[model samples]
Target: MTLSDETPGGAGMHVHRLLDEAFAGVEMGPDQQDLKEEMRGNLVARVTELTATGMAEPAAARRALDELGDVRAILDATESRPGPGEAAWQPPRVRPNPAFAVRTVVLSAVAATGLLVLVLAATVVDVPLAAQIVAVAFVALAAGAITADALRQETTTNHPVPPARAAGYGTATLLATTGLGAAWLYLRDAGLPWLVAGALLVVASAVLFTYLGATQTNRHKAWVLRQQAPYGSDRFTEDPAAAARFGIYTVTVWLVAAAAFVALTLTAGWEWSWLAVVGGFVAMTVLIARMLFAPKA
Candidate 1:
């Protein structure tokens, strides 16, 4: 079924455009033409199904393509014979979206500017505390935006992370950035409140990150997963229960660390409390190594 130009805007158009890009430069033998047609039909159906479920047409088309996973693999499979010295078929590289590239550049510039302002305020310039706070917030938000946008984009060998999960990652990034900023302010002798806020934000980010890691499923497309099969999957994929246990362990570690940090701040000193955070990080690293690298049963 040819995708006619007369077809109205929606999944059909998106699918057609995608198929054009995917099949470009490939010699269209009878078998290849048939395969392309079959793929186009299947992809259109999948996109239509996805769009019916409230997904945007563009996103639906992309998801459908992602599910197909490396169109070149299928094309290679259909080849009955290889001509003499047909150079190794390399998969087409997925280029970064122009719009996304521009967005990243802009956000990076903003983040850098914010950092410059913050350093100047803290060290050389006698900028107002309010202005310094604003600079910190800007940097945090820019970082968060970059993280979220990156997660939401489809990579060469992996599908886009779900929007909700991407947003969670972004939130964690923001919390960590803000926490670092707060810690810096406290080091500048701002106040005990800043110290408390910094510690809490850091702990919160750690918890969120642990949870995300534990719950994350593989997003690699079929071809990517196949290539990785020889290396073997992670223990968490093999035993989900282990992942759950690790998540619990991580949470407990961080909570205890937070409590210790507070107690040390009260009894020893704010200077000594940071040791609690460092200890917690070391504990978590050891836990990861033990869980992920233990001898396979």
Candidate 2:
């Protein structure tokens, strides 16, 4: 099986890249797809076998590939090879990123709580303890739902979204907001202001979720870009030094942000320290943009 460097992770990609180098000056024919699939299958099979013996997957894949010798040599040797049946191969799936899932839960919980508090305070101006408890429960439910979605997105980046599933989520959100709207219109005993606040909260949460989905989708775009960028393309211009410079810039920006966060906490109290972080993020984004778009020297 041909390893594809275009893939996000592993020695499969490394082997694929080496093959690409060997393919230089060779005309790609109709069998290109078959060759790629065959190569990938063989390499992955070897990796799986090695990992079965307790080798780490990455190291096993690497070792198995290295033992196979050069990509071009393997390709030539396998020129007359027939691939295994379709049942023997399948595409890899991305696992949910645990760190991202935890972050999402924390952030969603905070945002959900904020929205609930906003709605409760605006509607009643002074909510009773029981009312606040009910609001917190509702917010907790919303937070749970949002976190589930964010965890789902961790895997979504590795594959295309199913249209029916997308429709299901869209319909669910629409129905929820519509029900809230209907209550706002018909339930006069439930103060119009309170119902309206609830509806608005639903709408705001939906928008926030849309933003999160967009962010995850953008990650896939980055993977696509990396895959498309040829290793030898402007090699001198995109060398280790350039990467090191950007790495340094990133480190420096975050360090400055941390320092600012600490300084503001000391001088202006903890409440204002977060704003310093917000400013740092903006500044760092601008700096990175400038660096990326700067005229080549």
Candidate 3:
């Protein structure tokens, strides 16, 4: 009748399948994930003891699951608003990681210094091969660390930043490096001298900041939604309304950029019309930055 607690039975995998089936459409959070593990471990232990006591493996598993009863009912009763005997466990508050900040700051400083050296090399032609190599190494390491840290955690109990978004930030980091490098080299040939290179570098930096800031802001908002939502769920922005708004915002930005390009070409001629693209980018960057840092009241 009683089950042992030494180890899980061979029926462990089956029990997992059962649990997954029972909670198939359920939205899971960090605490819920933990509870799933707890239930799986406990049930398998019970089944193992039952089998040891001469019960068939399948029969013991069924018996244990029967004891488990309704999955939704159990989770609903336990996740939040715990009973008198249990302690409350909510998601922890977000805090800045000092090491992560250091990596970000170092990456920025290295990029600036490297660009300055590249600019200087245009005139001197002797920027030292060893220094260039060291600059490249530093950029790679610092950028990698900052990107990794962004996706590492949101709070103690939650993986708040979605994996999809994390992958995006990482991809942007790689593209940022390439874009800045290419723009620098291209402007050198375009003959605006140092100003063009500096402007391109500034644009690259702005774009990088916009991607990181906008995505991180969205991730935090999602976490807030999950914390306040009901039914043992942590899903966010899963509706058509949110999608529509995002679509509109995207379309509007591109429309403005295109309009700027045509207007500048007509008014200022071809030589300087390309600056419209840069102007539109700066405007969009300012908009995103404002939204990202807006008051959270």
Candidate 4:
């Protein structure tokens, strides 16, 4: 059937017209319905955004139409099985790369063990009792928050970074926290050794979490690149330096918050520390926003 016949219902008439203009010589038929639907959905989403940005309805529609180029070419490049007969075709399966999963599990386990030992040691040691207690609590809370946030992202969004990784990190954090709490209550008499062990565990957990976050960010960038590559568009190019800066800023904010927690613990005690922590968190959020929306060269 001809293009006009295939698009008979005019369900996406504007989109069809734009595609016809962009791909003047290409054939269109029922085989292309899926591609057309996908394009229409994406364009509508963009149009919604443009409307929010103060564009008039007609202007937004035109802009959305203009951005979608050479529809048949796009469909040909993006769809592996484009014909009507193969509409439900599935791609051949490939084994997943196991390195990231292996690393995540192994690092998480080691970090948890180290954090447990460190927390136990801190409790036993003759160091600043209040400071050590505060440090342990601070680490526990931060780790828990990170794990929670990661889990939320996994469940609530379409982002990369497998749910398995988030679960692994969360498990490690919980294990370390449990170990520390148990040692503090039961092995109180072991003194410095337990404190040292607990301290080590905390540090190890931090390192593991950091590695996981970095790996996750990399995975996300790779996904973005793959999505953009097929469109011959560089609108979302992965900038390693920019990503590195984002990471640095994130870590710095966390460190500052941790420091503020420790400071309040020492001076004003646990209850007061919450205020400083909250303030630090707000500052961290602002810093992250600035980094994300900074002018690009």
Best candidate per TM-score, number? 1
lDDT of 4 by residue, 144-164 (tens): 545644553422113444667
The CA-based lDDT of model 1 is what? 0.81
TM-score of each: 0.53, 0.33, 0.34, 0.31
Worst 10 residues of 3 by lDDT: 227-236
Candidate 2: tens digits of C-alpha lDDT, residues 171-201 = 4454454445435333535556666666766
Q: Pick the candidate with the highest lDDT.
A: 1
Error of 4 at 249 (Å): 2.5
Q: Is candidate 1 or candidate 3 better by TM-score?
A: 1
lDDT (Cα, tens digit) per residue for candidate 1, span 22-99:
787788875566566567667878987998899888878878888997878778754634453352332334778999
Question: Which pairs of residues clash in candidate 3, taking residues 3 or more apart in a chain or in different chains?
Answer: none
Q: Candidate order by lDDT, highest to lowest?
A: 1, 3, 4, 2
Q: How good is model 4 by TM-score?
A: 0.31
Backbone clashes (count) for model 4: 23
| lDDT-better candidate, 2 vs 4 | 4
Clashes of each: 0, 9, 0, 23
Error of 1 at 241 (Å): 8.6
For all candidates in order, the CA lDDT equals 0.81, 0.56, 0.60, 0.57
